[model samples]
Target: MDDQHTPADTPESEERSALRRVAGLSTDLTDVAEVEYRKLRLERVVLVGVWTSGTAEEAESSLAELAALAETAGAEVRDGVVQRRRKPDPATYIGSGKAEELRELVVAAEADTVVCDGELSPSQLVHLEDVVGVKVVDRTALILDIFAQHAKTREGKAQVALAQMRYMLPRLRGWGQSMSRQMGGGGGGGMATRGPGETKIETDRRQINQRMAKLRREIAELATGREVKREERRRRQVLSVALAGYTNAGKSSLLNQLTGAGVLVWNALFATLDTTVRRAETPSGRTYTVADTVGFVRHLPHHLVEAFRSTIDEVADAHLVLHVVDGTHPDPAAQLDAVRKVLREVGAGGVTEVVVVNKADAADPAVVARLLDEEPGSIAVSARTGQGIDELRALVDRLLPHPEVEVEAMVPYTEGGLVARAHQEGGVLAEEHTAQGTRLTARVSPELASALRAYPDYEGSAST
Candidate 1:
């Protein structure tokens, strides 16, 4: 968690002051206190991380992402530091000496908050805040804050609130006399006073629990409504495809290009929280519904995942998943792994995936070529410029599951509606009007084939 800071005058402080001189700070030192209390925004933040694995470049890339997240949340990143460690320190996240160095850095930079790249335990959160004398926030909380800011719909707001409450419940802290409350204070005046003091924490916990219960009920009600819609689509025999990938990876752009959905598209992270479904047809005239869902990130909060289960269920139930990746990103491989991890967590791992490297227009062609070489079947496309879109559509058409039953039926004019229904729901290879009624050859679902069983077969030889 990131928080405020006070100036210090030590050797480490002097060292940080020298480092700051070379880096050249952007925000004024006097404005730090004023910026800390600004509502609806977090300004002047310092980033810190422990590099446990990977090479130096990977560590730098991760911190760069953290800086971008902070900026997206309306914070100005002053300075970022990564400490080399085998693992994160248990009490303060970074080692004690490094924590002291960080405190100096915060003071030298006049940052109001320190954002960590990973989630911190309750003890670590408290310890770090005390050492740095500022607000401390982990990656999970920052992401949740962004979600809360972007959530617009009722269900989206409910999920964000539920996730925030769950994250806050465990990290609740008390000060002053609140910590002295009695666990059981049911008695006359004197004893009751002690009881109220002891039950203070319990009361807070109870209130949070109640709110959580209410939010869960609301979310379940909303999910039931969505399920009804999904069931309706299933009954119509329309294949469903879901678009999923890292946040800001152009999933929405692709959806708009494919279906003309005109969904709100912004370059910011988690710009669209609610799911958007649009009907689209493949090149072969096969109809399907494509749904764009919330994107994934590394170390996505578990509570957030649980809260959005219903929205993500679209991916699990989909016939195909378009795993879109931003080809211009510095670390596409890591982004792919993060997205795959969330998909598996949501039980969508077994679904067939078509890797689509989007944004080819802005990406380095050499890098795109290397990625395509590595992933033999993956396709590269520019959603904005419409490059390779037709090829993508053709691929999707080819990969979609075809109907199993193929037969020719001759129905009398009195049952002409059956022939029309077949034309709508199935792949009609050929159709002709005959003296009897209508002669039609189509590839259709088993249920539709059964319904048409009573119709007389065409006497002509049937084509496969």
Candidate 2:
């Protein structure tokens, strides 16, 4: 994860003072007391995956990422294995032979847990557990575990729980060691060492599902408020531009550069899961809202997407998207495709995209050259060095929506409200004072133009 997603800030320092508003920090366990306590300790885990396609190197990289995720979730990866299969076996995920091999690997490594690289059906999970005689978790569960550990805000926690419950719903099994408690009945030289069984797991699943429903209602209420906020911005005609990219693609770095958002740019997957928006001014002196959204990844769990639909909808509604890319990534092309796939999944497929190849300072020139050659209009820049930023800014100015009409208007001094609204909601090119009224040359949105037309004192002909 360190090598994958580092802070993309430049040394010349695009850093700015922290803003006054406190918002969107996740409620994950990062805030828990650091003192010694009796919480669960990290366990030894064996990583497993089935390779259906892709080069051996690609498969290895994917497994390496899974390892990083395990570490992030406070697990030690003891060993790993990959089984080549066209489709994961319904019963064991991997073939039975591979399962036996994996069991041996776990025993050899003394691993307490097995983590799979793909989501497994409930039956598959139960079968695998029975075969391996260890805790079996699929990729979605692992990702959710990471989210549960990392979420810091109330909303973040609620969302993570909702997603987890949805994923666990179908996988609820009738038997589990965590369920049946030892009844301790039959004694007399023949004591039974019974354990928790599946019934408890089923009950837990039901409770989780109930809680999930409640959370959905709560989030729906929150979404109402969000919609109101969005409408307010729309009423103000402030163009919203969302920054989206693969996890740790220097999005926060670029946001900090463009808008002075002091978002913590860390070297970790899902560093900025919560959305951060800041006021930004383009080179042409037009003001707009810029939002840095949660970074995406390949094969992001579907439940996560469903749970985060409201949050991701922000991307769909954006007037323009700044698709940040790590120029130094081994496969920038693949990274770009992953992002695009998520965008399409979220129903934001047709939105305008500006491919931003970030980290120019550290990126291989050959990669940069090839990317530039392939993507005709993509901008290559070192967010840390501010290289090519000016050009990027100009591109932003060109891409963002603006007022359609350039006209001169005269208004009475008393109508300062109109004047201020014009400056705030529309682009005011020039202003002057005369004895009869205030003279202004401005570029105004069509909607604002209609509103101005209704004013009784509206004067000054169009400057066509």
Candidate 3:
């Protein structure tokens, strides 16, 4: 968690500050709820969820997360309610009886919106909204709105826009009979149009499909640039570590703390959408890359996963994954499960992972102890306080993969570039000065080994 700062006067700072209004600030437990809702611009919302599975505590936590998401989207959560059920009612999600109950709560709470904890079908959304007499938003829509507001980069904005369009495509609604009319120029509008003509909903869907196709092509082009950079790093034999975890798990803060990357850190969920890569060094000065990617959430919108597939590959391709868990969150175990679920979905389930229990200073001692016990070898560290960071860095160095090829060579001083590459791309096992040049023995990539082998006079033993 990071403290809120006053905005500066520059254009860049102004943009960052405008977003700050939507990003919630970290606050004490007593006033944490108030901190998130203070800037709400009359978007009062009543939260509703159906507890189908899991314990009562998990149900409560899920709704709590929904409230946090609502607040993050600039909505005030007036009240929350959960209905017990074997499964969600197909028609209205929470059923007619509970819908009425929710209506009463919304009316009493003076909320103008009803936010559901699950993704509602188009019909369910309409029925529930009609019964509740307010604008109803499901979890998927709420998350998409947040992404739209927080995305800063061109790629990020394109991804979010594509996702929102996908979600809205099937839910295109039309008013009574007005949108059911035939097109005016239907006489020459072809076979189907010559009959009843194209309806308003049909026209809207066609336009949306066209727009979606264009967006897909744009996103693909942007992803190509990202792939090029990733491939370049691979050619250099640089190891990459990606941060993967639940939203607001203090990943950005941890990244800044470790490498002084200066990324913006916020206390809000899904605050960072664009992937940020920073150069990092281990205890022995071995160079590797650490990336702060978008955070995961329970039931994250499927459209988002599809739209951000290119970005999510950062984790799948990483040499190591730092699975950061918010030690202070009420249900850390559930958070862990949620993150790993998405990891598996992205084909990153088998990647080497290091569980990092963050916010140790704020987390309850018992909670931290239990997490550490459950996740053996997990490290408890506070980005805010710099606790246990040295140990964590050393551990990362030991766990990361090293170069496979080893060699010993003495080269002329003109090849000092090779020495630097040896230190950066691989490990320097030994080094000594010599009259001829520098004698070195180290583990290196096969490509680097080939380069080093070019020197005939300074040749030495080579092994896999």
Candidate 4:
């Protein structure tokens, strides 16, 4: 071979030229590069919203919340678009032209999903999906997905599953052969084989209904157990306070700070799904049980509210509700309204609520001051730094309903347990040791007052 063409004796310039020729041949052999197709690891989503009411700022804030919700659901939000409309388009929610624009944006962003900021009707959802050419989910479904992801406890899982099923039952669509009816077959065949059986959609609907029914029964049984526990607490005359708030508003953190519950706290939406009750003592040594329940969101799905009613009932049955708000949230007022709306829906409207501005350590002082002014009597505190906790405890102590009965009881040393019960159940105003046994003056529950009657020299008054 020639020196330039030989394997070991080729010149450097000739070798480079030969390598380039080979590369060109390889490129020519395949006009298109062999792109490896990988399944999308994360759902890429584009958000669309209609500004039906409220200012542009409010509309943008709502869209921002939807984006946060999408992120919480493990979706990468690629873009967000808001349309100014007097009302949502009955057919497409964002109207046909805006829906087309959204489709273009979604395609340009390589998004696989479109999330609407507001809940859409069935027709609207179908039409939007047809226009966007991808999976289209509304705000309700997005929140439900987040809930389904975060539910850990059995009851929590049941509630979330039930909500999802209910949401899905309406959105169930028939696609080609999946919607076909099964043909019934008989042992003898003939006309029996031609008999029509249930369609796949009907079967799915029936199965979902049956599952929802089962979940409801399970939830009812769980609710009964919770009610029994509540009854026991009532019998002991222990005041119950519930920590209620918007998702990720620091309720669990506050619960941990106040009661050392050690609840799992994360900086994500709907991090804690199950209700957690922890015993906390006030500054005056009065004991109360604080329950941290599921957080609320704006336009929370009605199915979820119904399914989680058993858990949320903790808030309704509470003697006081600490409405925790994220002080650093852009629209704390909107969050407050959202919470209040759910409270009303769950029959917790009449419950006494104390606004708690949480995340004070991270919030702007001016924002905190404004919240305090807007919420009158609202306390600003940071669960992380323990700021203003003492004041919050004192305020809780003051707000808890007090026993009206004041009593003086003299009992033998053998009944020391009853005396201790008096201290546990109500405020002990006075105590003294006497020759007979022990003299005591304490405000107690009616039941405790009745129980103290078993002792001698028991005098009761209706004044605290």
Candidate 5:
């Protein structure tokens, strides 16, 4: 009976029974500078948030999302707390009082880091860490860490590194020698400590700038290659579609379902960073290219947006944009707004957009119905179960822009390649084979129309 009454078995402590067990992310860096700007082992984290305005539920939801981000970074979440206040305290974010309370929670839970729900100023981060006596990471830093971990391609890695450099430029913290106030003269730590302290900071800043310039140059060079490929697609007159959405909203899953691209799909945030482009054919035999790009989150850092501008251009340059939203999320509308905000920033606001509410199988039926009603022309689909996929395919086919030029021509059996080109690059309105040649009527690009006119051996053809 007494054993049952112990602190570990108390109702208040039951929630700490390890729900998830994964290898903890190791935060060991080569130097203190690396520690400041490089990886952090957020192996165990305590989430803290300041509730300024929104209702209790909204605040809780925000914190819940933060918890998810931490877990994605390989952290074990032990506890989370929200403090009610007019606004985040200037010095410590959650106020010094709350920071102390958070310290208690961290110590009790044996957490090594405290993750805040909102981005913190450098001073706030330092002050809060001083009070809490543990590493403090804000929302922006946490998201950046996740991106750093998940980025796949060379360009993606460079972009993430540039963003990390941008983020750390203003918030660089120093240790021991770097923090020394050594001066050659008078009272300021005389001979022993009279070394290059401020010089160290300047040196670090210079190195960072040099590295950032190199990364920008490399990224620009890479962007050129991507643009050339896009131009090639355009030269062929293939319609392009880009998938944009909230992270974990099943965009990759839908892409796989649509084109069988077999792109890796994970249930983690920012799982897909590099843009993947694949060619797909509509049921009506119309061919269009589709790209599955990186996902967005609420309050995504501007540094990231600036760094990933070239990648985001995939959406801006696309002929159609599929904005995917997770149907099962508590606030589907919020996710929609967040993604739309990023799209607008990327100059994709003028592009044709189709809302795709995904994960319908796991989402509440009533919620799905309500969301579909709110979103006129939106399609609800379950990529896992293949529900509404046919309707979605048909809808996409109907919405895709059709070639304006219509032509009818007869080609020799030897020119079978042109006949195939008509079928692949344009919409085949009518086709008939006669002994003379195969007569074809199709709505195709001007380039294809010109090719038909150039052939002298082919029979009479007309374009309208």
Candidate 6:
């Protein structure tokens, strides 16, 4: 009955219906049998999206990216469709006609899964499954699945679980046989396909709520420990710089260049899920810590931001932010916006940012030139080549907090600590060891320079 030359009750359609019927639990299985029934692999998927305003090219690219995400999560994308509309249809995402077309396409393609390009409400998901006669997932769930795959650290795993639980909270079913067991079905009679959740959807909801609370409490305890470490760094007066950029940008690469810290460098998105901090001394001998945190992507999930807030605080508290960019990405400007938007959302908007255009070796000179034109004063460097590193060091030196006053200082024998402090903390230009103490010519902070004047045995003059 559809334009695709497919009948409404074709053999393929009937097969799909059969699959879903078996996917649901039957009323004649034992608990052990029911457990076996729950573990089914999702079938091949077909993607559907609506392009409202953008050009066809953009819509196609978005759909392609969705397909890649699906494949990453173990779903094979068999076919895709994009329809133009004023906006997404509220009821079915695509209109009824398109939904029918999708069902026929799913049958013809033998696709067992349907994934929408945008976030779908619970009602939308249910309706799509009904129309397409297969399991349905939206963009949000697909993203969550990917996060679940990439999460490696304990905190990362916990955060992913929290996000997934929150996402599933609203979609909990109410009247299913799965809920009936919780209502005290003893299962002594003809309970063929009986399973644990036959009566307790409410209990399941309550348990999930309890687990969500426990997860938050655990995360909070971990955050307190993280805060303690941050405070220790603050007390040491070590300047903090955070590396922030779009996912797949060369942030980890640059971090290794700066401090010789061998953080994992990968070509995949979200490669660095945990925050790593390393110590580095600036050209002026000022010690600072640089942190590499997770990268940002466009339309990043709001729950992810909330869950990762403790980790994101690295950027929020940093004295300076290194905004790395991939000079080779075709849309570097849009990538920059994505990074900045996430920073702003995380309350790191006002941090002083230094644009670092990395991976210059692979980037076209024209692309690099255009980037500099757009973001004047950005550092252009290739971590592999060690190019422009000295210039970068000089820039960090100039940006960091410097002494207000410059002076020459001489100290007593007992003030060796102050002498060493002058050389390490202060930017000592010249120094000599003497019987009295280390006589030094340095550009030091006024406080330390003033301390030197208090010693009569020390002979030093503050610069006018």
Using lDDT as the yardstick, the better of models 2 and 5 is 5
TM per candidate: 0.87, 0.81, 0.89, 0.87, 0.86, 0.80
- The candidate scoring highest on TM-score is 3
CA lDDT, every model vs. true structure: 0.85, 0.78, 0.86, 0.84, 0.84, 0.77
Tens-place lDDT per residue, model 1, 1-464, is 65544454556644532312113223333566656654546578888877778886777787778877887687888888876667788999986777888899999978889999999999999999999999999999999998998899999999999999999998998886556766444555564355344456767988999999999999999999999999998887878889999999999999999999999999888999999999888876778889999988888999999999999999999999999999999999899999999989999999989999999999999989988887768999999999999999998887878898987788788988777666656688888888987777788899888877778564755443
Clashing pairs in 3: none
**Which scores greater on TM-score, model 2 or model 3?**
3
Q: Candidate 4 residues 6-114, lDDT tens each?
A: 5434566333222010011001112123211212245788877877777867877887788888877767777777776667889999778667877888788788998
Model 2 poorest ten-residue lDDT run: 17-26
Query: What TM-score does model 6 achieve against the real structure?
Result: 0.80
User: Model 5 reaches what TM-score against the true structure?
Assistant: 0.86
- How far off is model 6, as Cα RMSD? 9.8
Alpha-carbon deviation at 10 in model 6, angstroms: 31
Q: Which 10 successive residues of model 6 have the least lDDT summed?
A: 19-28
Candidate 6 C-alpha lDDT tens digits along 32-140: 6644544534358888887777676666666766765676565656778777677777888886767887899889878888888888888888887889899989888
Tally clashing residue pairs in candidate 4.
Answer: 0
Between candidates 2 and 3, the one scoring higher on lDDT is: 3
**Per-residue accuracy of model 3 over 1-464 as CA lDDT, tens digit each:** 87666554456654422201112221123456675546545488888888878776677778889988988887767778776677888999987867887888789878899888899999999999999999999999999999999999999999999999999999989997748767556466765556566788888899999999999999999999999999999888788999989999999999998899999998999989999999999887789999999999999988998898899899999999999999999889989999899888889899999999999999999999999999987999999899988998998999999888987777679999998888888899988887877788889999988887665343444432
Candidate 2 residue-wise lDDT, 1-464, digit = tens: 55543333543222211111112211123435631241557778888887779876676667777777777677767777666566789899986766887788789878889999899988899889889899999899989998887677666777888998888788766545656754434533343634433356666776887888899998898778878988898877888899999987999989988988887887777866777779988775677888887778778899888888888888898999989999988788888998899889999989998889999999999999898888878999987889998898899888887787766667678877777767755678878787867787777887767656554334445333
Residue 449 local lDDT, model 3: 84
Report model 1's TM-score to 2 decimal places.
0.87
